[model samples]
Target chain A: MKPIFLLRLLVIAGFIGFVEALCRIGIIDNFTMPPPSRIAADLARALASGKFNGPIRATLLNAALAFCLAVTVGITAAVVIHRLAALRTSLDPFFATYYAVPVLAFYPLLIILFGLGSAPKVIIAFMLGVVAVIVNTLNGLDRVPRVLLKSARMARMGWFATATQITLPSAAPFVLTGVKFAVAYALIGIIGSEFIMSTDGIGFEIAFAYNNFDNATMYPLIVLVMIISIIVNMLLSIWEKQLLERRGLR
Target chain B: MSLTRIEILGPILVSVALLAIWQCAYWLIGDIALRSPGQTVRFAGELLSRPTFWPHLVETAKAFVAALAIASLLGLTIGLLLGLGKTAGDVFEPMLIALYSIPKVTLYPILLLSFGLGLSAKIAFGALHGFIPVALFTMNAARNVRPIFLKTGRVMKLSRWDVVRKIVFPAALPEIFTGLRVGFSLTMIGTVLGEMFASQRGLGYLLMNAIGLHHVDVIMAVTLMLVLFAAVISFALLAIDRHLHKRF
Candidate 1:
């Protein structure tokens, strides 16, 4: 690592150590806020016992499935809508309402419709992801240069051919941006579903720990989720940077 | 009619058609789990007449406003600090990003345990949700301040404060407003989520209660209220955004 990177890491470590020291010195009660050391130990125990793997697997599977479903539906809908200008215009309000509505508020309705299993969780995740994807894909399609479309038309390219050759390539970045948003939303939605009504998952574990007043366990579980999210986001950023470089647009 | 009027009317027609379809589908479903438009509206009317509804609404609104106020103050302070120093910005950016990406729903457990199922917990959660976007955007906007503008201000012998006030502030206003808009929405969402998880009162708790009791109509009514609240807040923010964008 570069010196700057090392220095940054040290700074973070120092901050954590300072907080830990404060808790140890009775300045901050562990009951109210457990120290980093306590949380780390709890995390180690959880890992050693393999207590977290199942929950992580379930949550990740739900997120992945929901993301794929949303993207598939979103892209197809975007393409169809883009092909018909009138339909796009007419659908604007519906889309706006969908975007604006807090889909979580409909969790009760979803649970009723889909039952208290993985189905509702997946559906919730899909609901959170799909609207953003659709809107972003539409925006991306709209951004395709008029000149390029005209050229494609002049070459007598078919609709499907033009879409595949021109529209998809031009829209890929924006679609990816949508996918990034969807990934976060899917995680939130899935975790939230688990929190509200699941028998198992990271959310369930956190809730269980809270009910038991096990601050050490609760804090570490929360920290673990935060670390996973940060890692995922960093990977997405790297992927985005590579894509931007290839397009020579960043 | 003019094109603009047609544009407006087209959406309204589509919305009505969609509502009609929903009502018809609900009618076909015909269960407590599925409520028709008429039933939903009736339930909402009934809720409006109930004495508890106002207080619940007020409590949620109060929590929302309090959270927003605290978030704005703290977010602005942190944003300014990070924005003013490149070293500070670089050091903290990753941490902010990490915190932002975390599914904060999980943190409700910790927050509830520490703060209890009270207004404080909700406010803290909302602040956490709102702070990241504000800080990130403000830092970016500050960093992107045109060098020529800064140089001109410096050559004119303006103080650092003067330069920030007269040039950097206005230049960054649009981005700051965008961040505020996003932050406000997230704050509202976070506050509601917090309430849902542990609160004794508020729309979230009420909705959960209704769900537990299998009162789908009441749940629908509460959902509609939430939708309206979100719409109103967003439109208000959007108007403010546009005005600031134009002014600056």
Candidate 2:
């Protein structure tokens, strides 16, 4: 890493260490705000006891399944809609409205429909992720140069060939952007669903901890979630950068 | 007029048809779990007429507004400060991004413990949700400010305050508005989630109550109202964004 980059990392580490020290010295109470050392110890214990594994696996599975379902449905819908300009315009308002609406607000209804299980959580994540993908994919495809399509048509390229060779590739970056957003949304959606109603998940675990006032356990779980989010986000950013560089869009 | 109308009409028609199918399916099912649109509407109307409805709505609205105000002020200040200094931006950006990516709903238990299951928890939740977007967006907007403007101002001996007030603030308004719109939605989400987890009153509380009773129709009605409320707020924000974009 560059010197500045290393320096920046050190600064962050120092800041966190300072905060942890403050908590240790009782400048910040452990009851309300546990120190970093305590949280790390809790995390180690939770991991060793295998208590964290089940919830993490379940939550990740729900997020992945929902993400797949949303991307499949969203991209297909976008493709069909992009073929008809007039259809896209009329449906724009609905998409905007749906985007604004907190899909979580529909959780109660979903619970009624799918019951309090992984299925409802998956459905909620799918709802949150799908529209963003559809909207982004549509915009991306619509921006393909008209001349490119016309030229492909003149070259006797069939619709399928044109879409596969020309449209989809060009739209990949935008779709990835949508996917990145969807991943975050999926995590939130699944967690929110689990919090509201779930038998097992990290969300449920947190709720359980809260209900019992297990502050030590609760703090570590929150930190774990934050770490996971950061890692995932970092991976996505690297992926996006590589893809963009390949496309010469970086 | 011809092709365009159909193009626009096609999706609307399809959507309406889909809704009709859903309505029919619900009617056929005839279960409390599958509430027909008509039933949901009627149920919603009844719920709206209840005295408890107004208080819940008012409480949610107040929490939302308070959170938004606090988030806007704090986010703007922090965002501007970070944006102004390259070192600050580099150091804080990853931290902000990490916090933003974390499912903020996870913090509810801690917030509840600290604030004790009251409006303060809801407000803190809303602030946490709203702050990240505003700060990030403002930071980005500030960084993107043309160096030429600052350079010229410095050459003309413009003070730091004047440079920010005249050059930076105006230039950043549109971007800030973009952040505000996002922040608004997040604030709403946070308030609802916070309320759902702990509050005794609010739309989220009522919706949960309805769910527990298997009052599916009431749940649907409240959800519809929530959607409408979100739509109205977003539209209003969009108008503001447009005006600011034009002015800037």
Candidate 3:
């Protein structure tokens, strides 16, 4: 494992060095891309300059809102669907194909209905993320030991209590997995929508910068979004592994 | 109904239910922001008949085909290489996963910068979206090939190429097909998205143009067509995927 990690680090460093060399040699012209070191430097200055504070805050807030909405609503819907065999069966096809359909195509209609504001982005993010949560939560629910539910019923526990105490705890790991996907989806939906059509946000800023050939601003902002997403994903992954290990399910 | 019957009937029922809900939403929202299912279908038919729409359709199709080809070929080659090399696979799998989760839309500008604003950029973007999943799935599938089979091949004094061709290829084909299925949709999405963001021709461009012009008819028609295309192809591929998995 240690050697694998070292090798991975070396590979990454080597790739970066290669790119840096290419940039330095003028093979990869400045117009196409700056070097990794330059991107990092620009990213720091972009953060320290605080010019992007507003867009960053807006994107983060909208993503959080969408993530929360997706989790809550998705879990609830999955629970209800789990109880109804017919509905669950019928909805299976939709869930399977949901991600394949470009939900971003509906952004125009959403903008029209909700107006050209953050509301549409949030809705798009919610739409993009909710089905993932539903599918994963449903999967987790399916694996909840029947014995646990039987014991709850035998103990005269109510549906809500059984759900909160028995089902949810048992399914927590899988739900966390769903939450991880939701984070990625929410970011993608929000940022993708903003890229397509929006007045403000990190995605908009990237697009805005790109249009003006502002490679400095554009590359830094792109790097920042990737760094933020990767960090969030890593944290969630660690938490998920811990949850699984604690449950003796890993 | 049995599970098989429900599986067949379910999607039809769901489609009807979806159309009903769409109709309801149309009535509620009125004509300002949406077109009804009937209107969308009619407009879609009109779009299909229009000669001007063909060029855009052809352009998108060409880009999508090229992207899928590149993604599948390159992804399979990389996946095979990594899957055959234990150390290499271990070193790169996590990196691929991290790349997968990143908002790739953020990287489109970089592609545009390198490839410029044309088919090449669009194909590159589409391939970028598609390549990871195929590689990941293929890597896992190849890595998990039965050890006994490889040992049998070694005992037969087969060369590496023969061992891979006669043993691993057949074993990994199903999962590789699954990867391709997913890659197909993602490539379509990336191509369309590339066109939407920056292009002169394609369904995506038309949708973006309609959005700018506030042409609800075109937006609904194009969106409806794209969704139907994606959903139909996905379902078909899913059926084949399930069949392959069951057989293997």
Best by DockQ: 3
> Which residue ranges in model 2 land beyond 4 Å of their true spot?
A1-4, A145-151, B1-22, B246-248
Question: What are the candidates' individual DockQ scores?
Answer: 0.56, 0.57, 0.77
TM-score for each candidate, following the candidate numbering: 0.92, 0.92, 0.98
**In order, what lDDT does every prediction score?**
0.82, 0.85, 0.92
Model 2 lDDT per residue over B54-154, tens place: 99989999999999999989899899999998888887887888788778898788777667777888998999999899999999999999999889889
What are the per-residue Cα lDDT tens digits for candidate 3 across A130-185?
A: 99999999999999999999999999999999988999888889998999999999
- Comparing candidate 2 with candidate 3, which one achieves the higher DockQ? 3
Q: Kindly report the interface RMSD of candidate 1, rounded to 1 decimal.
A: 2.3
The fraction of reference interface contacts (C-alpha pairs within 8 A across chains A and B) present in each candidate is 0.53, 0.62, 0.74
- Model 3, which residues run further than 4 Å from truth? B1-5
User: Which 10-residue window in model 1 chain A sums to the lowest lDDT?
Assistant: A93-102
Per-model TM-score of chain A alone?
0.89, 0.92, 0.98
User: How should the candidates be ordered by DockQ, best one leading?
Assistant: 3, 2, 1
Candidate 1 docking: what grade?
medium
Candidate 1, B112-179: lDDT as tens digits: 76677788888898888887888888888888888998899989999988988898888898988888
Query: How does the DockQ of candidate 2 come out?
Result: 0.57
